[model samples]
Target chain A: MPNQEKIRVNQLTKVFLKHKERVMALEDINLSIKDGEFICILGPSGCGKTTLLRILAGLEKSSSGEHQINNSGTDRPLQSMVFQEQGVIPWMTVEENVSLGLRMRHAPKKLINERTKTYLRKVGLTPYAKLYPKELSGGMKQRVSIARAFANDPEILLMDEPFAALDEQNKFILQEELLSIWEETKKTVIFITHSIDEAILLSDRIFLMSSQPGTIKEEVKIDLPRPRQMTQVRSDPNTAEIFLKIWKHLQTEVQESRTKNER
Target chain B: MEELKKAVEVEKEDLRRRQRSKKFKQILTISSPLFMLVIWEFLSQTAIIDPRFFPPPTTILQTLFSMSASGELFEHVRISLIRILFGFLLGVIPAITLGLIMGMYSSVRHFFSPLIMALMPIPTLAMLPIILIIFGIGEFSKMVTIAASVFFPVVINTVAGVMNIDKVYSDVAKNYGANPKDFFMKIALPGAMPVMMEGIQMGQAIALLTIVAAEMIGANSGIGYVIWMNYKAFLIAEMFVGLILISFFGYLFSLLLRGLQSKLIPWK
Candidate 1:
């Protein structure tokens, strides 16, 4: 049986009014996410993945559609987003950034401190809690962003390629860290990214999108067991098979984008 | 282990170099004023410049000490400070309040922008005659002149600062369900602070600049009054004393404001 529905997006359409010309960013986009499901939206650049995520997070209004994140009858906000670059407010210290959402909700002082400390430790940023974002390197800053998103304790996390700016080594480390955190918390996530390996590694289901007037092309389920590690992925035949299936679908879309650019 | 020791030696040398440069800068800062004073004294005493007109640094110091002892300098400084303090408050508080309103609402900005533009370019001193005629060459006109001088820059800078804040901050706050009060107190205020602080500092500077001109026009007592009255009487030494006092206080105001910035926004 399917898990409880955590998020539902129906007939979501977005159009950009570019100098009196309407550009279709997303057309009849529809998605359903289950409770605690780790879903990745994998697509090429300019494929409206970010727009989809923004709409889901309520950052932007859909031109036409119904998008709902089930609130679980809580008084708190239902979702939080981790943006790709420098989402941590530069003016706030690491601890303040992590404690922000809780503070805004007026969560008790004790709970705020406890949750902030817990996530800071999880992301290995406890020592740097007193430092500002300017003092942090890019990798460390992204870790703070992750810590902050998790610390908010939202019903769903919307991450828009949060680690896309990091180096390869940092990416692997953060991906591993994020997966471990997800395994522990089981928070439903809608992650947007262009990296195929990242989608395969972290996500339970990958929704692939085609470019230039973007729409979901296919949904590829990884069917991987929980508590998976990044190290043993190369030996898993399932990883290769899923990668190939998604690549086969994506290859043509990428080629089409390139040819259009050339023309 | 040998390589580690070599690294430690290199670090020690770097520290020593830094210390040497820091000491040199400190000496230069301390000696610069003294060097100028000494040059002025030599020029005056050796007849390179007429002592009657230029006066030696020593005579200026003597005149300042006597004036200070007789309570003349203190009275003037007190009167000047009171005028400036009141004038600064009159100008700054209203400017910030209106500027914030204008920045938050486009309609308010549209209404005020043209008026502010028209008045801002007209120099504060140029309005002195009209103001004196209206307010009768009393302390009121002087205060009004200083207030007008301070008002424009603060409003302009404050509006710019508020409008210039990145939309991302509001987006993040909105995503977290921040109410308007929390949004303003936590995000908008702090985000706009660096620029607002710049505006305040500029306001303080303009207050200082306009106070002197206002006092020079018609004032019974002030540092500016001392300078003006002494120049008229050809008490060159006392005029130099007044000029020095003005410089010292101007420098102090800036230093105090800078310290306030660091205290208020230590994140930077």
Candidate 2:
């Protein structure tokens, strides 16, 4: 049997109007993601990748076209988003933040605790469960946000550059943690990022976007095998080749956007 | 066991050092007011300044002690406190309710914003004559004036607090399938708490500022009444006593509110 279609975006477009000027942010975007497939929308700044993700998450409305998220049975929520900014509720303790989605769903207290503990442990944040977000580091705050996203156990995870703000060391650690969690759950993820290496490392398919009326330029499939190690993947010759391809497309867009700004 | 015992000893020493520093800071704070009192007393005793107009701290204390001993000061304090308490509650409950509502609904905000803006700039004391005319110089007029003073700051700040919450919080709430009730209770209220507490603090301050004016305008009893009566009679020492009482009340309320703020928003 064919793989189940998890999400479908058809002719998706967005136009932002400032005064009388009509600026097309995204144009004629089309995508089909399979169940449990990790997809990344990779682009330079002003490429409208975040806008596409926002539309997918129902946080924004597309000026034209439509998209659908397939129900992954009755037990799970449709989607949960891990924002680019620190998404953890500052007012809540780490444990409370982790369990917030479950609480919203009116899940039993026992299940909430269990899921919250599991995700907190997965993110290496069990000891800091009682601490508020203000007490945490930038990296630690992102870990809580990651734990909160996973603890909810949504059918699909929509992450918009969740690790984009972290330092190099912190980024690698979280990427590893995220992979471990995704390995266990295998939930469909639509992650948006500007980094080619990050996209290649985490995604099954990287959708490269072009700027100045942004749209998908190419879809590069990362055919690396399961249980991938970051260090091992870095050493693989195939990884460099894929990186060069994505980078070639991305560099042009970045240059184009820069020169356009100089005007 | 030996290591554990050594650690306990070290911890105790650290705690003792902290306590000593804290006590030193407290003494430093107290000395400021004490120095002010000493200077005033010196000036008055030497007749460098007119004691008739600016009585020394000692004279004010003496008058205060005598008035309290006769039960008159306590009666005025009791009545003044009661009026403030009632007026504060009257302004607070409705302001909070309406603020939350306005924060959630743009239409409601649009309707109320203009009216609130127009009324907010006019000082609560400026309305004293109209209030006195309407309520006829009774306790009601004084309380209403206090309530009016508090209402604007509390409402404006509460509205701001609610609106100022980051959009990501609400988006997260919605993505997680939060219903309207959950959105308000779990998200909006707690998110807005820091600023709401700030608003309440400001409201209490304005209420205190208005209360003296309200009482001075029309009332037979209360600290304001005492100050007005003393000023009219040229009893400068008694007026200073009233000033000290009002200051004490303001300081006590601020301390109480500060304690509450810390307890509620430990995250901040």
Choose the strongest candidate by DockQ.
1
Q: Candidate 1: which pairs clash?
A: none
Q: Can you write out model 2's per-residue Cα lDDT over A1-263, one digit (the tens) per residue? A: 12799999999999999999999999999999999999999998888999998898888999999999998568888888998866888888999999989999999999999999999999899999999889999899998888888999887899999989999999988888889899888889999998888888899999999996899999999999877778978999999999998888888888988898799
Error of 1 at A94 (Å): 1.8
Off by over 4 Å in 1: B1-11, B129-141
Assign candidate 1 its CAPRI class: medium
Instruction: Please give the C-alpha DockQ score of model 2.
Output: 0.61
Candidate 2 stretches with Cα past 4 Å from truth are: A258-263, B1-28, B132-138
Angstrom error of the Cα, residue A140, model 2: value is 1.2
